[model samples]
Target: MSILSDDIPALILIDIQKGFEDISSWGTERNNPEAEENARILLNLWRSKDFPIFHIQHCSSEPESLLNESNHGNDFKDIVSPLVGETIVKKNVNSAFIGTNLRKLLDTENISKVVIVGLTTDHCVSTTARMAGNYGYETYVVSDATATFDKVGVDGQLFSAQLMHETALASIHEEFGLVVSTKEIAQQIN
Candidate 1:
């Protein structure tokens, strides 16, 4: 099947917030420095095409969390800020489908396909993509438009950010959805 079919898919951007800039505090190396740039490209494409777009904001409840609403870091990155009339879904959890009416809005609009992009590939992005698939949406995850940080495993082995990012994509590639790039999705749209 085509990455995008005749039905136009909604672009769901997850947690593209300024909090991610606190790399020092995150305590991990990161990959895909150009992820937000790629995400911007996709967002522009979606806007230019007049397609549906959903912005998922991660509002942390913890006072110490950078993503807490009171913190400046909780604001959406300027590059991917939501335009008027675009849907903004505030989520406290990993999956956008949870604690938000994202699924309901999609179903109401009859949006059967979704193009997802965002921060921390291994966390929120992966969880949302899995739920999107299980919820029966034809999901496409833009690899270059998302990124993750290096992590130390339970065995105390450190994994590179690139490795974790690719592994996360691979885990969901066939069963959950297709893992693609911004350029590829743009081509399909054209």
Candidate 2:
């Protein structure tokens, strides 16, 4: 009943890490509470259907990086858990497919479309969506499933966090990918 695609789509979650909530980084002003809420919604949908879900965590060897240590960087809370047979991917870059077995996993599952959700819309979310589109996968970016902080422009203008959020939603919705609400997505598979 999915209006988007019925070809077995996988929910691709990117960078929903504990470190991101720290809010002192560049994302502090851009990250929205809605991202966390939407992620939980997506998680519920995936669990209800027992569909393919892949959680991508970011990691780096650099001493000061956000996801440097295994113990601190690799833990996803109860709010996010791997289903019985779901895959977990650890990535260093924004693109979930880069340096990960994501492509192979999708191919193995015969998933031609991806329902993407998670944090920092301007960074990882946007990057992965662009990559997915370029890779020829039918991509759908959940509009409320992503968030970011407010940023200042070169002209000394400060952008509203909500506006930035809308821009990200606009950037992908019906352009690079289809943007749907969580309710719409849930009803499709419910």
Candidate 3:
């Protein structure tokens, strides 16, 4: 009786790139300094089990963007860098499924469960989670393993990074996907 589905989940790590380190470009403040560590924990767990893993990279079309293909920021941070065997899905949009063989690869592997973890909980993480759920996969968005930067509203009101992160998780929980914690996921091991 595991907490997750019987089918082994495919870990989907989104945009854990060096570009996100340019905090000034992202926002004044970012939440979850330990996000990468938590994601690493899950990554290690999956590796121990020899489960599927997909490393989603954002290849920005904008020349000035840090994630642009021509820059060092496009490279993955060492902590969660993809190994030789992991699948790398590069996308220009927020969703990982767009313009990529993410679905085909998942289907090819016969994987129907996905555990999503990554940078900016409110943006790419949320978008990918929504699409994963809509695609009929058993999706789980790891709350502590995802984070976001502060955002300014249309009227210039500042929203804290923590607020954005929480709301995004809440929005997806039990609707588009299940929002879970890394500890909860680890406890299911056995």
Candidate 4:
């Protein structure tokens, strides 16, 4: 369900940069490839509608860090040409709004709702979603549009991609924003 008077919705894509995939942290994940494909679908839809699309790129000054690489670090690939003139917010942290003009940009555009879709569901995606909600903007997490890899827990147990996806949905779906699929999002926009 859409929020009240929330007609101006921007799709905020967080940390879908190249480094996230190439880094050793997630290079061998089962859902990595699928997640990229799903993200592409959502990006295409938003681009087609000419909606305001913003991308957050994570970069670190450390020379050896994945985000510091010249070629692969935090750069969008050729497969996705971010719409011309769309703002690309550079960030050094997980939350896109932190120390960035993202919040100001949204406020300038009078955007009350944000449709979030990007890589690594448990990291930047989750953090940014929560932050957006805290900022009083209606946030929607497009499920297939976000994905994460397996991570070992403190209990010496590994959480699979599917498990992470489900857990994220359960935890933040209703509180932060409605959890939706790419298909459902497209239907709503159409």
What lDDT does the true structure give each of the candidates? 0.93, 0.77, 0.93, 0.77
Model 4 agreement with the true structure over 10-105: per-residue lDDT tens digits:
988777777766545563454545556666776887788787889877776676777764647557754554777878888877789888999999
lDDT of 3 by residue, 137-167 (tens): 9889999999999999999999999999999
Tens digit per residue, CA lDDT, model 2, 1-190: 2544557678988887776666666543654577667778888777777778898887866767666755464456456756666788888888888899999989888888898888768778888888888888888888777777777789978887778778877887766788887887887777
lDDT of 4 at 1: 75
How far residue 139's Cα lies from its native spot in candidate 1, in Å, is: 0.6
Model 4: CA > 4 A from native: 3-5, 69-71
Q: Which residue pairs collide in model 1, if any?
A: none
Give all TM-scores, in the order shown. 0.97, 0.87, 0.97, 0.89
Instruction: List pairs with backbone clashes in candidate 2.
Output: 29-149, 29-150, 30-148, 30-149, 30-150, 31-148, 31-149
- Model 2 Cα displacement at 74 (Å)? 4.8
Which stretches of candidate 1 lie above 4 Å from their native place?
none
Clashing pairs in 4: none
Measure candidate 1: CA RMSD. 1.0
Which regions of candidate 3 fall more than 4 Å away from where they truly are?
A: 1-4
